[model samples]
Target chain A: MKKGMGTITAPWKQLLLNALESNSHLKHSSYFQLATVGCNGRPSNRTLVFRGFQESSDKFHINTDNRTLKIEELKHCPFAEICWYFTDSWEQFRISGRVDIIDGSNPDTFKLQQREKSWFASSVKSRLQYLGPNPGLPRISEHQSEEEVRLDPSIGPVAAFCLLVLDPDQVDYLNLKNNERVKFISTLDVNGVKNWTSERINP
Target chain B: MKKGMGTITAPWKQLLLNALESNSHLKHSSYFQLATVGCNGRPSNRTLVFRGFQESSDKFHINTDNRTLKIEELKHCPFAEICWYFTDSWEQFRISGRVDIIDGSNPDTFKLQQREKSWFASSVKSRLQYLGPNPGLPRISEHQSEEEVRLDPSIGPVAAFCLLVLDPDQVDYLNLKNNERVKFISTLDVNGVKNWTSERINP
Candidate 1:
C-alpha cells in the first residue's frame, strides 16, 4: 500500500499543491464549490471549505455535518464535482470524482480513526459548530443560540461531525495566463491499481 | 407579459441584490460556480463570470463559448445549478433551475437582441475570448496562437458567443454568522402564473 501520496506523485497533484501554496495569502482560496445531484433529481451546488489533503493521498478532505442536505444528496448520488479557483494565479481546477462519507456508522474502523483525527485537528471554534443546532433548520431566537456550548473536545467526533473524502478521477486545469489548459485522468486497472495520464489541451 | 421584473419582486431577489451590492468591492465576487449534469451521467462543475440580471427580471445572464463541453451537456439535460458565496457578508446562495441557451441559431428574435446587447456590453478584452482558437482542443504552439486576432468590434457577436439564462425555481440562502437559512421556492400554475413562497429554515 502507498499509505500516502508520498511516492504516488502526479503532475496535477504537485501543480494543485503549488497553487494552494501560492494562494495561501487569500483566505477564500481554501473555499471551493461542490456540486452534487440532489435527491429531487436537480443539480445542487454549495460552497465548502477544503479541509486539506487526506492522509497524504490524492483524496481531498472536507468536514461536513452528517445532518446537512449534502449528506442526503450524497446518499442519492455519490459522484460529485468541485471547482477551485485560485485568484492570485488566475487558475481554476475542476475535479470530478466519487465522494465517500465517513461518519459514525461507517463500518471501516480505520476510516473512523481518520474521522476522529479530523475532529480533534479542528480548532475549538470549529468543533463547536458541530455541537450547535442542526443546519438548514429554522433559526432559533438569537438569545437561545448565544448560550455556551458544552461539547468535550476529547470525546472524539460528535454524531453530526462527518468527514468527506473526494477520490478524484478527472481533473481539468485551466490557467488564464497565456490561455493554458491541461486535462489529467486517473484510471484503475483490473487489479485495482490506479494510473494517471495528463495531456495539454487548448484553452 | 411581464417582460421585466419591474413589477415582480421576491424577498430572496432583494436579498441577493443586497449581497451583490455589499460585495462589489471584490472582483471575484462576480464569479460563481455553475454545475450541470454531463452527458456521461456525471456532474460537471466550472467557474463562470456572472454577466448580470437579464433585463430587469430575476433571470441571471451568463456568457459562454458555444464550443465548450457545457453546450453539449446542456443539450443532454438543461437542468443546472449555481452557487455564489459572498465573503464580506459570509452568505451563500444556491440557485437551481433549467437553463436556456440563446445562440446564433436561437429562433427567438427577442433573445437574439439580448445576445447582441450582451456582446456590445462586454469589454474588448472580454470579446476576444470568443475569437480565439476553439477551446479544449490541442494547442497548436505558442507562436501561432500569439498572433493578433482580426475580430471586428462593430461586426457584433461572433458565432460562438452564446448567452445562457437561468430562470431559477429554487433558491437556498445560508448566512453563516448567526446560522440562518431560508428556502425560496417558485411554482408555476396551469395558467402560467408563477408564485414564490419563502420559509425560514434551519442553518
Candidate 2:
C-alpha cells in the first residue's frame, strides 16, 4: 500500500484512496464500468462517469438518466457492482454495493444537497444528456447525427435527472503489477458510524 | 460508423472490429472488465485479459483460474457482461453474454484445438498467472512480494487453468465523442447461422 496515507489507516481503504489521489488513470478519466443485475437475473454492465467518492461513508456517486434501463433494473434489484481499472498502476478495484437513487424528491437533506450541487456544477453539455431522448430508445433516423440529436431545441432537462449513490458492502482492490489483492468489507453501526474490515488476499 | 473502408458491413460490429484494429487502448492494454452475478444475485466485476476474439463465431475467449469465485459464479449462472473502454477513441462497448467454460477435456475438437493454440501463444509471464496461489485467498505475510510468491518452485500449472468463452447475445456500442449509442442483438437461426440486428439508440 502507498505509505503515509494517514487519512485512511486500513490497507484496502488506503489503497483505494491512494489510487483515487495519485493514479493517472483515475486522474485523467472519470469513467468506470457499472454492473447491475436485471429482473431476469442477467448481469448487465455499462460505462459510467465516477462523479464522486466519500471515504468516510464508503460511498460512490454516479450520475445517470433516471429513465435508463439500468435504473429500472436497479429499481427491481438494488444490488450493483462497479469496476475501475488504473492502467498506469495496473490496479483494478471491484466494489459491490447496494444502490440508492436520489432524485429531487429524496428525503435526505445531505443527498438532495449533493444532487443539486452536482447538477449545477455539471456543464451544459453534461446537463444536455439528461435533456436528450430517453436513453436506450431506438432512433428514428439512421442519418440523425449525434450533434443534431443533442442540440435539438425541444431538448430540455425534465425530471429524469438522477444521482446514484452506491454504499459499498465489499470492495476488492487488486494490484496486478504486485500480484496482491485486498478486500474491505464495510459496516455501519446504529449510530451511523462506518467501520471497515480489511484483509490481504491473493491476486 | 466509418464506411466504404469496408471489411465488416454491420455498423455495430464494424465499430467493434474497428476498435480492435485501431484503438490504442486495446493495443497497449489487454485487460477488460468482466461482470457476473453471484449466487446471491449481486453483481461482481473484475479486470481480465482479452485473450482472443472469434469473429466468425461471435465469441470472446479469456483464460482464467478455474477455482476463482467468478468461475463458480458462472457455473450457477451463465449470464455475464463485459465492458471495454477505448481511451484513445473515447468509446465504450458493453457486451452482455452467456458464458461457457472449456478445458483440455472438452469434447469439442475445435475448442480443444483453440485452447492448445492459445496456451502455446501465451508468454511465460502469462503462463505464470495460472501457477499462482489460489485467487482471493488471504496471504500469509504483508512482506510477501509477488516475485517471491511466484518463484516458489512448488508453484506450477494445475487443474485450475480454464478458458472462458463469452457468446454475446447483445452488444451496446457507445461513442462518447459523438454521443451516439448503438445496440446489436444477435440471433441464431435454425440453420445455425448467426445474424445481427442493429439499431441506433440514445446515449
Candidate 1 lDDT (Cα, whole model)? Answer: 0.86
- Report the error of model 2 at residue A123, Å: 1.3
Interface RMSD score of candidate 2: 1.2
Best by TM-score: 1
On a 0 to 100 scale, what is the lDDT of residue B93 in model 1? Answer: 93
TM-scores for all predictions = 0.94, 0.86
B29-121, model 2: which lDDT tens digit per residue? 456889899988888888888887753455788988887999889999998988888877777888888898877668987766666666666
State residue B146's C-alpha deviation in candidate 1, in Å. Answer: 5.8
Q: Which digits, one per residue and each the tens of the lDDT, describe model 2 over residues A1-203?
A: 21111234434656766777666444335668899988898988888888776434447778888888888899999989889887666678888888989887788877777777667666666776675676889887666543554443343334788888887778888887766778888776675445678888887
TM-score of 2: 0.86
DockQ in order:
0.77, 0.68
Quote model 1's TM-score: 0.94
* Model 1 agreement with the true structure over A57-96: per-residue lDDT tens digits: 7888999999899999998899999999887899999999
